[model samples]
Target chain A: MPMTTAEKILAAHCGRDEVRPGEIVMADLDLALANDITAPLAIEEFRRSGAVKVRDPRRIVFVCDHFTPNKDIRSAEQVRLIRDFSREQGIENFFDVGEMGIEHALLPEKGLVLPGDLVIGADSHTCTYGALGAFATGVGSTDLAGAMLSGRAWFKVPVSMLFNYRGRPGEWTGGKDFILHTIGRIGVSGALYAAMEFAGPAIHALSMDDRFSMANMSIEAGAKTGIFPVDEKVEEYVRGRSGRRGRSFPADEGAEYAARFDFDVSGLEPQVALPSLPSNVRPVGEVKGVRVDQVVIGSCTNGRLEDLRAAARVLQGRKVARGVRVIIFPATQRIYLEAMREGLLEIFIEAGAAVSTPTCGPCLGGHMGILAEGERAVATTNRNFVGRMGHPRSEVYLAGPYVAAASAVAGEIIHPARVAGGDRPGEEN
Target chain B: MKIQGRAWKFGDDVDTDAIIAARYLNPTDPAELGACLMEDIRPGFACEDVRGGIIVAGANFGCGSSREHAPVAIRGAGVRAVVAESFARIFFRNAFNTGLPIFESADAAKGIVEGDEIEIDASEGLIRNLSRNETYRSQPVPPFMRELIASGGLLSYMMKNLNQEGKKK
Candidate 1:
């Protein structure tokens, strides 16, 4: 039978000839991940299960990113519990504070997740690896415990939704804009329990970073996972990072999709999700001039090197507006060092933006760059749910780095194209 | 498989963050987490009103974030069962894994009002609204899932199976 990429991967992992949507299967995992917040509970469950050892210590990864560098005494205690458990279990993939990055970003860079792999994490953004063609999804900590004890997790095969995009994106428009637009069209619950597959010409043209950003936000639309078919770009990225040829499972011609959406991106504009829900999206042009007190340009969604470079291009030779706090965070230490070596760090610092270490940080309201009460922020993060970044009264507008950087300079939300040719601070006079 | 309680009402899209804020996620103890359940939106819900009640909510209850804390907090706060128009997928799985019973009944969601006395026969998937004297039907809980809940959750279920296998060996 013809199958989508997700179905192909799940069938292979479950040792079945074929699996269809809605079929429950227990599949072996290629990778299992947990971070500070989820790991403590998973560890407690593992101990209670009387599992003397994890199924495969090498396949499990423990990353301490969220609340790391411990926000408070309780956070400190949580991290300690994870560290101790990793050591006791002799888990080879444990990443401590200095070595840690956001798990989604770090796992791919470390070559831990490969195309056609079945992965699960306690973090919702585990679906991010679907950018590389992996069948990945999030589960609760007890499920993680089951995966740890048995190296297997259960899944209900999800019906597939195909999104076909044609035409190239306009300047200042990238993955974040594309995803926000998609979410706006399909409300938050539109794709409930379905795998979303990106296809067609425009998807083939997107860089891996763009694909990652797009796939990372699939959960915001309540998708089971978002995936892009493996192509030359994914092959090139995987080969460069792992020194191994990338593998791909293409959807069979005429494979049935539960639903299909077609988009033409030729005239796409930058998009910003309004406060309280990721589905509340508007074009930057429509919402321009809305004042903001903070601008944040980083998260698992948009904190890659390419995202920083885009922000740097916008912030170059400009200063952040007075009374607006601009903050930048690289997704990982590797990306941070690359930005530093490329002078992107200097550009941000000279522009008066504070660059912080690669933690989930303000994106999750964990620490750093938290918004004050009633403050408004334009951010490159994923969700804009109430109190997502500190005070419940504070508002967050989700945008790409281009919009975030431009908004930081203007002290309000503005499209980057509107400021692209404007005078720089020193050149104005 | 049977529960009787007063109904506390909520609207649609009550996300996991609203059910339990991230600020109180530091502790893993269910009781500690329970104390803060719905504190952000309902303020005193956990302490004053969450005792042995049924949550009757509109569509897409427990949306956003795959935090098991949402179900654990609900179960810990003495919520008997959650009857909603629908449930987000992850939360549905987490609820069963934590031994928290949940039912989906659009009719019950629309017909039941706040503080109405309600009884649920999960095995039969029937909800009786004592206040209105009306009965609503939902998808019956599958036998396997009822077994998991009867064992007090997935962990206990797995342990029981393990012990039975040991006896057979």
Candidate 2:
């Protein structure tokens, strides 16, 4: 049988020759995970299964970072439920609020996952681990509970889409924009039920940070898992950060791919996903005249320190446009502290940007940064589906941190090049 | 059992957020969820004349996020099965869990174009694309999953199996 990168990964993990899409393959799970928000519910379901002990306590990982530091009574209660469950179940990989970062960031950092592994988590971005060459994806509390009880998951192999990124990115354009452009071309469900493997010269040239960002948003294209072939960069990342070096699994040179995408990165400009859809994209120049009421820079997407620095470099010594609210939330507390140590926080405060604690807020419209009716905002987070950030009537434009910061200062859709020294003297107004 | 349906073709990498947007995260009703099916990902999707048919795609279908609503909404929107080049892991299980059959053929989807009336034989991996009068072989579903799907999802299958076991005991 002709094998694709996805088939290679799944076959490597499950010890299979060929597996079809929609056919159930019961395979051992490398890791099963849930965070505070989903962990409690998983625990409840696990207990309801009438099992005296968890199937494999060591395989289960629980983290508390969604509403970390006890933002409210409910959040605190949720944390405690996970804590008690971990202690009772003897789960060795449980991490508390302060000890945990974002669930997606912390798991890979802990050396708990390896290349060619199959993983499942309770969060949608569980596909984030595919950056390490694993076929990881997300599930709900009920499904996770089943995995917790059995240490096994049933899966149907997905179709594989090979994203062949070519050419070097233009100056000031980042990984976020590349994905935004991919979504623009593919629409929303372009890679539905398929594995997206990032290959080619351009993708290989990207730093690990950039690779993570690329793999992270594959979910946005409606892919099952997005992956990169494990190489020295992955080995070095695991060794340097997690104290473990995983086996590398590069796709065979002649491997089959269902759909092949060749993207040229040259001449690409800062892009945005207009309100209610990631694929509803346009060049930043087209929406330059649009005004904004809010500018948010953070989320699983573009909330890392690099993203903060990019936004900071643009906002330095510049005050936010009057009546335009700029909110920045780092992805994790470590990123928050790192930014503070480097005085990025001060630059944000001085520039009139409201910096909030690390949380999945405004991104989910759960707590902070909820929008009112008829409001408009530009954000660096992934996804801007209707009512995603708050009110259904509120519009959201998705961009990278630099563009997000520039929009905050201009109080509308402004390109980062205009503010970040990329534009010619008389080119942009 | 063999099931027949029309084929609706797509390219690849259809993420869950596109199946059901993030804005509808809190909704639990499958029917209400059906109303918003692929509205954002593919506008006018519901009005696109899809009925009891299979969605054929290139590769990496249902990639982003592990929201089961993606498959549930698609099935609820009158899709009986999805035959794709591949599927996202979560969506694969979610589809079967809800009794929606999915077929895999990297080239199976390629052979049949849009508006192809096809007969799917899941057990044998046989598909007859009536539009092109072509017979293609797809990846066959495992025997165990076929039973679960035939009995209408994992929960219902398990309920019937457990009840039988109880009677035997």
| Candidate number achieving the greatest DockQ relative to the actual structure | 1
Query: TM-score for all predictions?
Result: 0.96, 0.77
Stretches of candidate 1 exceeding 4 Å from the true structure: A240-246, A422-429, B142-144, B150-152, B157-169
Q: Pick the candidate with the highest TM-score.
A: 1
lDDT of 2 by residue, A212-260 (tens): 6777788787777898888777777777554444555666667667789
The Cα error of candidate 1 at residue B133, in Å, is 1.4
The per-model DockQ list reads 0.58, 0.19
Task: Mark the 10 consecutive residues where model 1 chain A has the least summed lDDT.
Answer: A420-429
Q: Pick out the ten consecutive residues of candidate 2 chain B with the lowest summed lDDT.
A: B153-162
Tell me the docking grade of candidate 1: medium
